[model samples]
Target: MEIGNLNDYFKFFVALVAVVNPVGAIPVFINLTANQGIKARNATASIAALSVGIILMVVLFTGEAILRFFGISVGSFRVGGGILILLMAIAMLNAKMSNIRQTKEEELDSTERDSVAVVPLATPLLAGPGAISAVILHAQRHDSTLHYLYLSLAVVALTAITGLLLFLAPLISQWLGKTGINIVTRLMGLVMAAMGVEFIAHGLKQLFPILGAS
Candidate 1:
């Protein structure tokens, strides 16, 4: 909590950023909102960003309660989340995981017009199961309320920044070019995969007493 000890908070911020990878998500955002008008696209981005912030806050505050309600331990959630992240990393590495086509199908419905941000963007794309699980695990790790608040704020700020960058994704995509984007995506996938392995290892260590003892 002291000024000198803020390093931990900063470290947490970096970890959250790496896990969320807002910059890495920009291309997907561009692809998803390609069909919408400028105004609609901007609105969707704003809503999606706000939705992600809200979802993170919920996980930070009530994540334990939610997990308890479901009779799921934090270790269990991490193991599951680790697997999900691994799958996502594979998709990122392969570059064929965009849900734009599926989103387009859903958008074809009249009632789906207002749900764009909440549906594909906010849910699976931005604050999907992997993100939710990550935040919940983070909350469980941080016992201090102040640290939790700081970490949550950092996550929200990072998410908002990512969303803002995503709103200008056309320019970013042009600047990055296909090759640059592919390189960045591959790098992010590698990092994500490593994180997934760490999560799995942590969960297994917790679940297996012998592993923890050794």
Candidate 2:
């Protein structure tokens, strides 16, 4: 494999990590599952992680098709998605969850829901719009089955790490504390903002070839 391919893989993974911000979700996870027993909590974590994996995998494979069906070009999507991610990054920088991921109503609804695993935790929290857009953009990078398989593995590995963190949410929360979590979240936000800018720049180049000529 070319070194550039390896680098792309690494970049893709880092972008996903930043967009997902699994560690940042710990506080929300803890609060959502607070009333549950250890076994229940673990189950919730597993389901959430699995849901994330499945959701991303589906998006990785079919996202392009969906975009095409809507007559949307990748360049246009990158600009739009980049803006969404940039907004989320701004929120992250402030150590706050973006309403784009989950709205105030959703957060309130999550508390009363019977199963928070698939709804708020897995959908918007762990695999929200930013995460989905990141996956779709990466999917557009290569159109090979092997490449898709490799990306799939990366998704699986990421979700596994996320699951482990969620399963150990209490310990992580205690260790990091609120201040530490906020610190980490802010760092992630910085990374995410860079990624968003990169996406928008690349997209603009694609959309307006004149930009690339310069």
Candidate 3:
């Protein structure tokens, strides 16, 4: 509603984008769909995008309740999630996929599948723990109904953009080339690293108000 709120939401959106880093996943999408025709690749992209959005939205809404069941404190979860995100950020900085999301074996296995829309693409790549945790942390921190609605919209917007990128994977690949993609990935990596540090700092502040005040 206000400019500050809009800016906050924009940061939230950026955190989602950075953690998911769809641009970084483009090469993987291309490799996975290399065997398919253009139509099939587009189909896979659509499904993966929709699935990822739905999964993350569910987590965003229900994450706190799930944590309660598991007896995990928000601050504790924030610290852990920050670590996970930081690890992925480091991996991205190196221009490689994070092993936390997928292993080399999993990537190899995707090649043997008929469709990878839900496998490595949607789960490990898009809606992996890092992304899910980030959304959950954001949701938990901002629990207003208005924020919840905005979060859902943000997820949809992100997924749509990611799908568009995947749909144009070929053209994007040709345009960006390997070096360009790596450059973009590294930039996003820097953003992710900053977000990760912020998450950890917030969590620590919550746990230690004295340090936060200082």
Candidate 4:
């Protein structure tokens, strides 16, 4: 690729990173592996990254079929994703605890011990519905196979880098401090909510001719 094309891909990668908000996930990772040793924490991070990467690749490659299997149009998916993003924003804005927080209760309630990697860390935390939807939408926006490949690779690379960063959760948390983390989370929440609304509005305009005409 030419320098210009590479720059474009870089921009796309950056946007995906922002949407994924891996840094925002650091706190969640810390909480999830609070009891684990360093080796366990590292293993959990590796598993989480691999799991998330696989999910995104699957969504990118087969999202259309997956949606069709459920009889869902892209427009419908966008609307649903918008609602989810909005809810996440509301939780962030209100400083409400996430479902990952509830995992602690589940741990206390259950005798079947599970690896933290598979539960709150990997599922709803890393490859959550919002992230999956974003990946699908990103894939849909690409027209060329080359572009898709570039974007897909970029997404994976960015995700992996983010996961690696999160592996240093203790250092990051200390660097950000409590108040700084809260501020960053709220800012990201606002941005995510806006992005969600924009996706919904764009989908509505595309799917509904009357709305577009108006």
- Candidate 2 regions exceeding 4 Å error are 1-4
TM-score of 1: 0.83
Q: How would you encode candidate 3's per-residue C-alpha lDDT over 1-214 as one tens digit per residue?
A: 3122877778989889988888888999998898898889899999999999989988987899999999998888888989899999999899988899899888789899998999889998889999999899888866677888888889999999989998988899999999999999998889889988988989888888898789
lDDT values of the candidates?
Answer: 0.72, 0.93, 0.88, 0.71
> Candidate 1 lDDT, tens digit per residue, 1-214?
4222467567556555655666666766776676889998888888888888887788888988998999998788888878877777777677544442234455355234545676666766667776777777767776776767677777777777867876887888889887777777777777777777878889888878699887
TM-scores, each model vs. reference = 0.83, 0.97, 0.96, 0.83
Over 43-102, each residue of candidate 2 has an lDDT whose tens digit, in order, gives: 999999999999999999899999999999999999999999999999999999999999
TM-score of 3: 0.96
- Model 4 agreement with the true structure over 10-77: per-residue lDDT tens digits: 75565556456666778777876777889988988888888777777877889878888999888878
Candidate 3 regions with alpha-carbon error over 4 angstroms: 1-4
Pairs of residues clashing in candidate 3: none
Candidate 4 residue 112 C-alpha distance from true site, Å? 6.9
Error of 3 at 91 (Å): 1.1
